[model samples]
Structures are given as structure tokens and as C-alpha cells.
Target chain A: MGSLQRLGRWTLGVLERLGRGHLFLLRTLLAMGTLVRRPGLLLREIYSVGVLSLLIVAVSGLFVGMVLGYQGYITLVDFGAAEALGTVVALSLVRELGPVVTALLFAGRAGSALTAEIGLMKTTEQLSSMEMMAVDPYKRVIAPRFLAGVISMPLLAAIFSAVGVAGGYFIGVGVLGVDSGAYWSQMQASVDFHEDIMNGVIKSMVFGVVAAWIAVFEGYDATPTSEGVSRATTRTVVHTALAILALDFILTGLMFGDI
Target chain B: MTTRRIEITVGIFVALGLAALFMLAVQVSNLGEYRGGDGYEVHAYFNNIGGLKVRAPVTMAGVRVGRVTAITYDAERYQARVSFTISARYDQLPTDTQASIYTAGLLGEQYIALEPGGEDEVLRDGDVILFTQSALVLEELIGRVLVNLTGN
Candidate 1:
């Protein structure tokens, strides 16, 4: 009886989480409603997500590019095609790596905070006060973070991509004795301004919206207690990371027309 | 009063920015000038491109001046024909300039690399580059090297 009841409870838990996800989507749409009426929130989001996160995006991107160069050159050398290393690094970073890695970073750094902040308010009965005061928390809180994450994630992603390319170049041309002039020329030619860059930015924007929505939903719907707030924050970060990765695969297939 | 929210958010952005700066420095320095040098567009024929794709680099004397723009097979020729757009600066190539397929690293992509010829007359645009070396496939090269070493 105990084990059966436990299994039943597990099933219920899965369904509950799914239901919460749907509610989050609904609320996200609701929050986005304020985009036109109050555009200031969008600016705040760009500042918070884009400007603030540039450092991590840059450093991580550089190292990623460097490693790509270091590794790519070696593999190509064995194949007697060492000159193609730049293309490999740039394409991979633009098409997939940059957006996904930045999303994970954003989730770890900001997603949890959003969830906790909202959850804390929920536990403190502050959310109730906001509602009582005729303040739509969705507009005041969720919308800002959602738009900010959307705006900022792409900007940071671009920074990451640019940095990563530089990193690869440093290792390839500086250390590996690759011709600097040619290296740059090849990379420039390979990187299509519209196709590669646009794809990544678009992915980042979508990821931002999804991440912000997940975090906010966790916070706003959190139980009225301290433990609930903590749980909400943790859940938001983990779920956001997972969702970002899943979205990456889907978007890649969609954009590339992959079967 | 400083809110924890503001503090965490600010810290996150600052950290990300620093990383971005480092990455930018690497990319800019590595790529050098993006403009193509004075050179000629050349096509190479191959049985298999072998990991070669569009936008691959084209190198001469170990210096890159162009990239592979397209890869297609001429049914009549029965070989993979790769088109490379080289720069205008690298225009001086003997009619005997050889286009060899090379790679940056093992498991890396294919690139059409050029070797200048001793001839005085330069190859013109849309001219079929005659002296050519096909890509050395990794497996084939290794297999041959090992066989030579083993006297098999």
C-alpha cells in the first residue's frame, strides 16, 4: 500500500510540474502585454542581461575559441588540412555553442535570482499586497526580466561569438604559426553576417524569454514558506538550463531544415 | 538601500563583460585584415572533398588569402570541383601555380591551398589552375605511412 501510494504521488508530481509549465507560458504572454504600454521595462532588461553579462560571455568565448583552435589545428594537421581550423571554430560557435552556453550561464546567474526574489515576496505575503494595491506583478516584475533576458541574452551571445573567434585566432595564428592575414581572411569569408549571427541571436532571444518565464513562474507560484522559495529558485535554474539545451536542438533542426 | 536583487544582477553582467572583452581581443588579432588579397579564382578537381565544405580557407605559402566558395562536381569531369575566391593583392601567380588540398588539423575541414610557380605569366580570373595536388586523406596517409614503416 505504501509503495503504491508513493508511485501514485510521483505521477501526480509530474503532472503538477507540467501544469505549472503551462501556467508559466500563459503568464509570460500576460507579462509581454506590457511591452508596448511600458517600454521602459525593456530597456532595464537589456541593461541587466546584456551589459552586465558581457564579461562572462567574453572570457568563456575566448577560451572556447582558443581551445577550438588548439584542438582543431591538431586534428587538421593530422589530416593535412590545418588551414581549415578557423572555419570549424567559428561555425560551431555561431551555429550552436554560443547561444547554448550563454543560456546556461544566464540561468545559473540570473534565473535563480528571479525565482528566489519572486518566491520570497510570495512567502512574505508581499505578492498579495501587490495584488491588493492594484499592481500587476506580472507587468511590474515578470515582464521586465523576460524582455531583459530576451534582449540581453542575444547581445551577450554576439559578444561570446566575437570573443570566441578571437580566442581561436590567437591560438591558431599567434602560437601555431598560422598566417594571421590568411586566418582572418578565411574566417571573415566563412562567417556570413546574416546567416550565422542572426541564427544565434534569434536562439538567444527565444532562450531568454523561456528562461525568464520559467524563473518568474516558479517564484510567483511558490508556496508561502521559506523552503518553498528555496525550492523554487533551485528548480528555476535547473529547469531553465535543461529547457535551453532542448530548445537549442529544436531550433537548430528548425533553422537548418534538418530532418 | 541596495537590494540583493540589484547586487546579483550587476555582478553577473560585469563578469560576463570581462569575458567578452577577452574573447574580442583574440578574434580580432587572429583574423587580421579580412579583405581578400589580389589573386585569381581557381577550381580544383577531386574524387572526394572529405570533410571539405563551403567557406573553407584557401592558403598560399602558408598564408590564407581566400576561401572555398562552392563545391560541385562536373558530371563530365567526374570530379569534385571546388571554387575559391582569392584576394586582389595576391595576383601574381605563375600559370603553373598548383592548388593542393590541405587542412588546419586532423579531423579539420578541407581547404584549397596554393603554391606559387616559377613561371612569369600569371593565371587569370576563371582560369583553370592546372598544376594541382589532391587532398591527402588521413586514413590513406596513415595506412601508407605505417605500411612503409613496417615494410609490408
Candidate 2:
């Protein structure tokens, strides 16, 4: 009886939090009206969230591409289809890995940072003080950060995919002795603009909105305490990762199911 | 001072991201392909299209001249009708051109190959290639071989 009661309580708690999170998101989005007037605020958050996260995303992209090149060469060579190394690498990166991996990394880097920052503000009573000063903290504080995240995500994913493609090119053509002409020509022939590349860009944009939403919501909803701040930060990372993966599955099905 | 630095860094970051997208579109994908919008449509009817798909390259003498645009079934003629577009530059192709579906590599994608014939008449928009060969299905080939062996 007690176990069943605990399960019911947990379900209700989750439902309540989910409802509250959606309300917070709606409010934050509504508060974005002031964004155009204060572009500097949005730019500053973009600098922190997007610019700061570029290094990890690029370096990881390069390594991932190189590894794919090496592994793809090993397997494709067995089939005597080593000429398709570029197509394999580019397709995989743009279609699946680019947005998905970049979002995972962004969750760890920017998502956690946003949560911790907002949680800290709440913990230190800064948000409360802002409330006292007749300033809507959601407009002044949270909206720009959330907007920065949404804006940065697709750009970051694009950078990752481009760098990854370069890395794959270097490893496949330079190190693995694949023909440079075949490498590029095959990729161009097979990778369609609307089907593969644009689909990836659309995917990254969706992921961006989602990652930013979860980050800000978690931070805004955090309990005003030191431990609560830490816990919220952890939750931001975990939730963002799971959300990205789940959304990736759904997006891939909808986008590429015909292929 | 820090604000200026932040603005500059953000500017550079935005530029880099845009540049990356440009590269993906131009270099990685087929967005840079010459889409002159000066192409003429041609149709061909085949016994079997096999794995032929829309947007498959239409090659002439080993050079890509166009792409397959539409694939449909001809209920009246009991054939697979394929519609493709050839760039205006290749407008001199003879009306007697033969269209055949061929696979690249062993297990690669299928494409339509055009073999030019000696004719004064040029293929215009909406003209159908009368000579068409279907894609070679491996299963049918094996079945034929088995029948011949058993009969022998």
C-alpha cells in the first residue's frame, strides 16, 4: 500500500512540475518582446553560451570525423567500396551525429552553466531583489539567455558538421589514400541539398529551442538553496541529454522515414 | 572595453557559423550544382524501372546532363514512364536517343543512361525516347540461368 502510494505521489509531483515548466516557458517566450530594444543583452548571453561552447564542439567534431573516416575505411575497403568513404562520413555526420552530438555537448556545457547561473541568482536572492526593483526578471534576465541558446544551437551544430567533414576529408583522402576526386564527387552526387543537409539544419534548430527551453525552465524552477542550485544544474544536463536523444529519434523518423 | 571585446568575439563567432553553413551547402551538398532553370523535359517508358528513383542523375555518354524528375506508371501501356530534364546545353541530342537504366558499382544507386543515335531531329521538351531498356534485375538473371541449366 505504501509503495503504491509513493508511486502515485511521484506521478502527481512530475505532472505538477511539467505543468509549471510549460507555464514558465510560455512566460519567458512572452517576455522576449523587449529583446529588440536591448540587443546588447542578447549578444552578451550569446557570447557566453554560444561563443564559449564553440571550442569543445569543434574539437570533438574533428575527432569524431577522423575516427569515422578510419573506421569507415576499414569496413568499406573489405567490400572494395573505399571510394565511398566521404559519402559515408558526410551523410552520417550531417544526418545524425552533427545536431545530436553538438546538443549533447551543449547540454553539458551551456545548459548546465545557465541552470547554475540562474539557480545561483535565485539562491543569492538576486532574482528576488530584481523582483523588488519593479523589474521583470524573466524579461531582463531569463529571456535573453534562453534566446541566446536557441540562436546558438544551430550555428554550433553547423560548425560541428563542417569541421567534422573537413576532418573526415583529411583522414580519408590524406591518410587513408582514398582518391580526392572520388571522395568529393561521390559526396556531392549522393548528398542532396533538401534531403540531407537542410534536414540536418532544421533538426539542429529544433534541438536548439528544446535545449534552451529545458535549461531556463530548470533554472527558473530550482529551489533557492545551494544544494538546490547544484541539483538543478545536474538535472539540466541529464534532462537535456535525454530530451535531445528522444527528440532525435522522433525527428529522424519524421524527416528520413521515406529514405 | 570588455563590452567591445564581447561584441567583436560574438561577431566573429556568428561569421564563422555562417561560413560553416555556407560550406555545408556549397561544398558538402549539391547546392552548388548549376541549376540554370534552362532545361527541357523528356519522357521514356521502360518495361521495368527496378530501383530507379526520382532525382537520379541522367547521364549521356558518361556525363551527367540532367536528372530524373518524375516516375509514374502508364496504365494504358503497361509500362513505367520516367520523366527527366536535360540542360539546354545538350539540346542537340538526337530524337532517336535510347534510354537505359543502369546501376553504378555492384550494389550502388540506379541511374538513367542515354545513348545518342544518328538522327537529324533534336529531342525537344515533352518528347519521349522510343527506345528504352529496363534495369537488369539480378533475380530474373539467376532465374533464367537456372531454367537454362535445368533444361540442358
Candidate 3:
């Protein structure tokens, strides 16, 4: 009886949390209706979130591409298919790794920061003070950040994929001696813009929304204490990471399963 | 001044991102290759397609000129019929050009390879190449080798 009661309580707690999350998402979306009136706020958030995340995304993308190129060269050489290194590296990065890795990094860097900033504001009574004023904090604060995330994610992913392809070219052609022309031509032949690149963009956009949502929501719901803010920041990273991965699998299956 | 700087920076960022996307679209995909009405289709029949798939490249003399558009099994003839589009730029392929299925690199994907003949006639849309070779089955070759060795 005790165990069963505990299980019931746990289930109720999960459901309550889920309900609150849904409500938060709806309110944020509704607030987005008025975003055009305050473009400056959105732009500022974009600079903070998007520009701030750029260096890490580019560095990681380059290294990841180099590794893929080297590994792909080793494997393809064994089969006398060293020329196909371009297609293998480009397809892997553009379709799967670029968007997913960028999102993961975004979650770690930007998502956690957003959560901490907002949670700190909440703990310090800044958010309540805004409420005491005539300003709607959800409209002024959360919605712009959310919009910035969604807009920035796909762009960041594109940069990552492009840099990654260049990195692959550097290692594959320069280091491994794979024919440079063949590498590019084979890649051009195999990958499709509509099928691979567009799908990856869609995935990053969805990830951006989900990660930003979790970060903002957690901060809003944090208990008014330092420990509470810290916990919310941690939760933002963990939840955003899990959500991005899970969404990637589902989106990949939906986009590429038939082919 | 600060606002202008932020706007300019963000504009540059978005521009760079869009430029990257355009490069991916043009350089990595078929969008740049097959603009509408720029290619012609021809069909070839083979006894087996092996692992041949749609969108596989069709090459002549190690240069890509087309892609396999469709693959269908003809139950009556026990053959696979492949339809492919050759770029309009390469429309001068001789009518007697022979189509053969060849594995690209060892253990790699299969593609249709064309061997041009000396005939002066050029192939047109709906034309069928008469001379063709099917995919070589590795399993069958191994089985035949095993049988020959054991029997001998």
C-alpha cells in the first residue's frame, strides 16, 4: 500500500509539472504576438544568444569534420574507395552531426545562461518588480529570448555544417591525399538540398524552440533561492540535451526513413 | 551608435548564415544540376539490378552525365528496367552506346556505366540501349568457385 501510494504521488507530480510546462509554452507563444512592437529587445537577445554561441560552434564543427575526414579516409582506403571520402563526410555532417551537435552546445552554453539569468532575476524580486510595474514580463522578457533562439539555431547549424565540410576537405584532400575534385563532386552527387539540408534546418529550428522553452520555463518556476536558481540552471541543460537528442531521432526517422 | 553596431553585426551574421545555406544547397545537392527541362531520359533493361537504387549516378568514361530516375522490375521478362536522365549538355551519345552495371570501387554502391560505340547516330528520348550487362553477384561467383574447387 505504501509503495503504491508513493507511485501515485510520483505520477501526479510528473503530470503537474507537464501541465505547468504546457501552460508556460502557450503563454510564451501568445506573448509572441506582440513581438513586432519591440524589435530592439529581440535584436539584443539575438546578439547575446546567437553571436555568443558562434565561436564554440565553429571550433567544434571544424574539429568534428577533421576527425570524420581522417576516420573516413582510413576506412575508405581499406576498400579502395578513398575518392568517396567527400560524400561520406559531407552526408554525415550535414544530415546528422551538424544540427545535433550545434543544438547540444547551444543548450550547454546559451540555455543554461538564460535559465540562470532569469532565475536570478526571479530570486532577486526583479520579475515581481516588473509585475508591480505596468509591464508584462513574459511579453518583454521571455518571448524575445525564445524568438531569438528559434531564429539563431538554424543559422548556427548552417555555419557549422559549412565549416565542417571545409574542415573535411582540408583533411581529406590535403592530409589524406584523396582527390580534391572527386571529393566535392561525389558529395554534390549524393546529397540533396530538399532531402538532407532542409531537414537538418527544420530539426535545428525545433530544437531551438524546445531548448529555449525549457530554459525559460524552468527559470520562471524556480523557487526563490540561490540553490533553486542553480538547480534550475542544471535542469535546463539536462532537459534541453535530452530533448534535442530525442527530437533528432524522431525528426530523422520522419524525414529520411522512407528513402 | 550601439544600436547601429548591433544591427550591422546581426545583419552580417544572418547574411553569412544564409550564404552558407545557399552554398550547401548549390554545392551539395542536385538543385544546381537538373534545372527543369534540361535533361532527356533513356531506358535500359538488365537481368539483375543488385543494389542499384534510384538517384544513383550514370557515368560515361568516368564522368557523370546523368542519374537513374526510376527502377522497376519487369515480371514477364525477369529483368529490371532502369530509366535515367542524361543532361542535355551530353546529348551527343551515340545510339549504339552500351549500358552496363558496374560496382564503384570495391564493395561500394552500384551505378550504370555507359560504353560509347562507333555508331554515328545519337540516342534520343524514349530510346533503349540494346547492349547491356547486368550486375555481377558476388555470392554466385563465390558459390561457383567453391563448386569448381571441390569438384576438382
Candidate 4:
């Protein structure tokens, strides 16, 4: 009976936390209107989130593309369909890997950083001090970061896909000796803008919103201590990764389930 | 100031992102393929379209000369009407061109392959190619093969 009571209490605690997170996201979204008044702050956050994340995103994209090319070439050669390597690589990256992988990297890199930065500010009493000074921290701090994340995600995903395609070309055509013209022509013939690429963009944007929401909410609600900040940052990464994967599945189903 | 430098870098970053998006739209997708002035349309009717889709390439002797623009059901004739536009550079195809839907590679997309016949007249806009071969249904072929195997 005591253990059953403990289980009930644990479930209630999780529900409460989830409710708080939802409220925090709602408030942050409402505060986003103030971002237009301070474009410079938003741009700075974009630099920190988007530009700083570019190196890792690009490098990973290139390597992923190369691996895809090498693997796809080997598999396709067995069936004498080596010419379809480009279509395989391009479709896989643009439709599935590009947005999903970019979002995962963004969660690990930028999301954790945002959580840590905000948690540390909270621990240092900066957020509270700003509130005392008549500055809404939600508007000045969280909104711009969230807006920047949403704007940067699709761009980062696009760059990842582009670099990935180039890397695939380098390995598939240059190394594996697949016909270069066939690679590109087949890809162009198969991939549709509204069907494949735009769906990826929409996916990245959704992941951006969910990831940024989790990061800021965790940081803002963190206990004002060193250990608390670290815990919140870790939670931000874990939660963002899970959310991105789940959202990817749902988005894929909605986008391609019919066809 | 550092602020101006950061802004410039961000601008460049955003510009690069936009360029990548444009490349995806134009090079990867079919956005830049249909500019309207460089092609002329021709029509054909088939008993079955199979997996043929709009934007499927129209090739002549292994060269892409056009693309399928539209597909519609002709209820009156119980056939599928396919419209395609050939580029002006490849506009010299004879009026007797036979349009056959052929699959690219095994388990790949189906495309219209134009086999030009011996004729002096050239196909023009809105002209219909009277001869056409419908796409082969793999399932039907496999079923026929299975029936033959069972009967033997």
C-alpha cells in the first residue's frame, strides 16, 4: 500500500513538471512578439546558435554523405544499379537524414549550450536582477534565443543536405566510378521540391521549436545552484533528442504516409 | 565595432543558406525545369499509365528531350491521356514517333521513350502521336509467368 502511494506521488510529480513546461512554452511564445523590437539581440543569438553550430553540422553532413555514398554504391552495384546511387543518397539525406541528423546535432550542441547559459544566469541571479530592473527576461532573453533557433534550424538542415550531396558526389562518382551525369539526373528527376525538400524544412522547423522550448524551459525552471544548472543542461539534451526523434517519425508519417 | 562585424557575418551566413535552398529548389527539384518558352506540347493516349507520373522524362534514343506535363483520364475512350512538352532543340521529332513507356532500370521510374519512325513531317504543338505503347504491369507479367509454370 505504501509503495502504491509512492507510485501515485511520482506520477503526480511528473505530470506537474510537464504542466509547468507547457506553461513556460506558452509564455515564451507569447513573449516572442517583442523580438521584432530588438532585431540585433535576435541576430546575435542567431550567430551563436546558427553560425557556431555550422562547423559541426557541415562536418557531420559531409561524413554522413560519404558513408551513404560508399554503402549505397556497394549495395546498388550488386544489383547492377550503380547509376541510381545519387538518387538513393539524395533522397535519403533530404527526406530522412538531413533534418533528423541536423536536429540531433543541434540538440547536442546548441540546445545544451542555451540551457547551460540560462541556468548559469539564473544561478548568478542575473535573471531575477533583470526582472527587478523592469526588464522582462522572457522577452529579452528567452524569446530571441527561441526565435533564432526556429529561424536557424531549416537553414542549417539545408546546408547539411547540400554539403552531404556534394560529399556523396565526391565519393560516389569520383571514387566508386558511378556515372556523374546519371547520378545528378536521376536525383533531379526523382526529388520534388514540395514533396521532399519542403517536407524536410518543415520538419526541421518543428524540431527547432520543440528543442528550443525544452532548453529554455528547463533552464528557466532550474534550481539556482551549480548542480541544478548542470542537471538542467543534461535534461535539455536528453529531452530535446527524444522530442526530435519522435517528431521526425510523426512528421514523416504525415508527409509520406499516403505515397 | 564587433556588433557590425557580427551582423555582416550573420548576413553572409543567411545569404549562403538562401543560396543552398535555391540550389535544392532548382537543381535537385523541378522548379527551374519548366520555363515555358523553350518547349512545345504534344499529346498521346494509352490504355494504361502504370506507375508513370507527371514530370517523368521523355527520352528519345537514350537522350532526354522532354518531360511529361500532365496525365488525365479519358472516360470516353477508357484510356489515359498524357501530355508532354519537348524542348525546342529536340523539336524535330517526326510525326510518326512512337511513344512507349519504359521503366528506367529494374524497379525504377517509368518514362516515355520516343522511337521516331521514318516520316518527312515533323510533330508540332498540340499534335497527337497516334501510336503509343502502355506501361508494362510487372504484377500481370509475373502472374502470367506463374500460370505458365503451374500449367507446365
Best by the lDDT measure:
2
Q: What is the lDDT of residue B11 in candidate 4?
A: 93
Model 1 per-residue lDDT at A49: 59
- Kindly list the per-residue Cα lDDT of model 2 for residues A1-259, writing each as its tens digit: 9999999999999999999988998999999999999999999999999999999999999999999999999999999999999899999999999999999999999999999999899889999999999999999999999999999999999999999999999999999899999999989988988999999999999999999999988888899988998999999999999999999999999998876
- For model 4 the local lDDT of residue B49 reads 93
Docking quality level of the chain pair in candidate 3: medium
Q: Over the stretch B72-121, how does candidate 4's per-residue lDDT look in tens digits?
A: 99999999999999988777889999999999877888999999998999
Q: What residue pairs are clashing in model 2?
A: none
Model 2: CA > 4 A from native: B149-152
Ranking by lDDT: 2, 4, 3, 1
lDDT of 1 by residue, B46-117 (tens): 776777788677888777778787889899988888888777787787888888887766454677778887
For B44-141, candidate 3 gives per-residue lDDT tens digits of 99988899999899999998899999999989888889999999889899989999999987777899999999899999999998889989999988
* Local accuracy of candidate 1 as per-residue lDDT tens digits, A1-259: 9999999999999899889878767776777877888766665665655666666767888899899999999887876666667778888888888889988888887778778877888888877898999998777777777677766776677678877887888899889988776676556556665566667668978987888778778888888788888888888888898898888889988887751
- Share of reference contacts kept by candidate 4: 0.64
Segments of candidate 3 deviating more than 4 angstroms: B35-38, B94-96, B116-122, B141-152
Sort the candidates on TM-score, descending order: 2, 3, 4, 1
lDDT tens per residue, model 4, A72-169: 99999998888889889989999989999999899899999999999999999999999999999999999999888999989999999998999999
